[model samples]
Target: LQEYGLVSYHSLNLLKTQALALGLPPADLRSIKARYSFAWNDQGIKYLGITLPGKFEDIVSTNHKKVFAETKSLLLRWRLVRLSWLGRAAAVKMTILPKLLYVFRMLPVPVPKPLLNVVHRDISSYIWNGKRPRIPFKVLSAPLEDEGLKFPQILAYHKAAAIASLSESLLIHQPLWTYIQSIALPGHSFPGLLFTPSKSRPPLPTALQITRWSQNVMTNTYSPGPMPHNTVGGS
Candidate 1:
């Protein structure tokens, strides 16, 4: 059976030689489009719907644009049908938010404040059908038992996904991605870094982003106080 996979290597000549040794056809090797840090014209490759190796901010921005465009197009089509406000809210929850939520879970990066503001505004406009809103967004986002529509809160969802990703990394059997990220975090353990001051933490973006997110989760969920710590052994 013939199987194909992406090959990443530091040298094209070495890669070609290895591929030839593995019985891969020379023609297939020649046809492969290679991307690397130095490729001026090559954007990152897309895998599982994400464009990799690009600036995190740029990737999040691109995702937001695509999601926004798709959402607007969907809302435009839905406008042709006579849906009530509750129906429209349900559509937004069912259709629109899921798209962004997928991106949120996949990327697990902080969405820029301006982009978030734009998303909230666009969702508001789409849900209200360009009319003045009769209900406040906060009330709309509350549960139905609280006399609300149970609208999805985009920012809150994003934060939850990021915090979940961070928690996953802390598991005793760390994931491959967590192990890879630890290389960037040299000398400091993940738990140790959690207790470290913001200025003292390593300069890894994902670590810092997740730390801030975890802090935000704690701040919102509890009263402010110095976090208690236990030292097991003397250093």
Candidate 2:
């Protein structure tokens, strides 16, 4: 076992025997002896579980059950987090290559500089440039699935699907949708003012349309004239 680097009782015995046979110096022997003592270190707490003269069981009272419970709870929590990460990473690895192909397909065939810039900027701003890196799949789904809070690192497969679908098919209506927002305004206007984009626009408004009009232009107006004056019994 020692020859193959397996840690086992047989390997330890073989190494010890060979060291003794070589007539290793006293200092080396002491180092070798130290290594044989089985110990466990947690944070800074060291326990010579087997080799020390007294074990923790002998010094610490076993009746303090709460400490053991806390330790177990902490250990279980750590394991749960570790296992969750492992599972998520494994799933990501399996889907990443295929999903990336879809995202690339979503990319415009003859990508324009400005449009690419917009896509890159939106993807970077909403998806990439944050502390958490978005998984490609997750980036696709986020706006659709309505996942409010997002972590940069982990993205789900369904989300990538959403992004892919949006890229391939959903974005087709973007131009028409935007055209509608630009031409229409919402609700009845006040006596002096024009329409605001809410009531008249589509079910939604584009960021651009809102940006084109100033807030003052969108404000509601009261009646332009005051009540008619009474001209001393009738004019």
Candidate 3:
């Protein structure tokens, strides 16, 4: 158009002339299709107020919908199954665990205990027919040789996933991790090594912001007792 703020798009000969006619800055008239190369991007992929393809350190998910919805759908449908105890265990192993892992692939944080407990309640109902199990849950969690179903523990799994995600940035020395460390933990190093900044040296605002944001994400993901809070409002 003749006058517009900024609309990023692929380059063509006419568009360049139009941009010049509009008196837009030369720097503003350009394309990134080749640079980005992101397919199936109709909306250009936005996250955390920044446009994609953003930094690895900026990718933080605050809530989960896909995982919760899939798990809930499976749990609800599982009610109609008329099966024995061990048979029910097989059903869970086949139907539920796979869905859980599917969601866990995208979910980088540990799900809250209260939310996970509700799912576990649905799982408990499916397994024991809404009756208190003869064996304790801790015992029920044991391996087959120890005479247990080796049931999936949601909280444990979530925490493990979170730890694994943290390790991506903290332990593994990938290119993304290296870039993140330079910004996030500039002074700090592994094995408890950190150099103090001098009067001339100072922490960067942008780096500190990203670092704190990442830390907050990990902080929010904590494992707790298997009890859904009473104030959990859902019908």
Candidate 4:
């Protein structure tokens, strides 16, 4: 169990180390892709077509605005009916529906192994079968960390598309979109939010010091003590 505790929790420790190295209030560059168009020739990137206006704000301004507006109106009506009971909570939570939609738009979908393999084979065939020389390994190896071995743009598009497609797919499988309601929405209570700079211990839990002393004490106490004082003074 102790060994399991160390290795099993390596990632947790790694994340802490990374967070500490990053210093306090970790630096994150909120991608501006959603609200603003990149200088790159977006039209030239044919693969990115499926996800144009890709910035977080661009979706709300263009794609999700209609859904948000309609839902806001409907929620407003619902609030009017029960304002005395749930107005404030509804206003705080429901008002962020559009933002929630934008964030959900970023979730990566879980692609099954067989289907993803097929897609990889398809992409490889499409690239390698062309009459021209194949794209160099440098291009193909751009996203080594990601499974698809696609360029960043393609990776982002696939991730976003996976989220979009899966959300729709779940509805297709279940119909009624009822299951979507259970999906977690971002909140202060999320585990990611509770995270602080790695070097600092969180104040909420009582101060529990993790130290070598405990391990030393455990090892010494559990070990056989001085061979039980040698009954006959010999083996």
> Which one wins on lDDT?
1
Error of 1 at 159 (Å): 2.1
The list of candidate 3 runs beyond 4 A from truth reads 1-63, 169-175, 190-235
List per-prediction Cα lDDT, in the order shown: 0.64, 0.33, 0.52, 0.34
Query: Per-residue lDDT of 1-235 in model 3, one digit per residue for the tens?
Result: 2223335453434333311112235454335433333343422354433333223332332235445666677767766878887687678778887666645544444355677887777777778866777667788788889987688887777655644544454454554644655655466552121111122234445534533333434344543335563211111
**What's the number of clashes in each of the models?**
0, 9, 0, 4
* lDDT order of candidates, top first: 1, 3, 4, 2
Off by over 4 Å in 1: 1-41, 53-57, 195-235
lDDT of 3 at 113: 65
Which digits, one per residue and each the tens of the lDDT, describe model 4 over residues 1-235?
Answer: 3476688874333222211111113233224333333333322222211233433234424433343355445544554443422233234334443343343354232233454343333333333432353555355456657543433232334344433433343343554432332233223221221122222322322111111122222222233336554221121
lDDT of 2 at 81: 43
Best prediction by TM-score:
1
Per-model TM values vs. the true structure: 0.67, 0.15, 0.53, 0.21
Once fitted onto the true fold, the runs of candidate 2 whose alpha carbons sit more than 4 angstroms away are 1-84, 90-174, 186-235
Off by over 4 Å in 4: 1-108, 130-138, 141-188, 191-235
Q: Native-vs-model 4 lDDT? A: 0.34
Indicate the TM-score of model 4.
0.21
Q: How close is candidate 2 to the true structure, as a TM-score?
A: 0.15
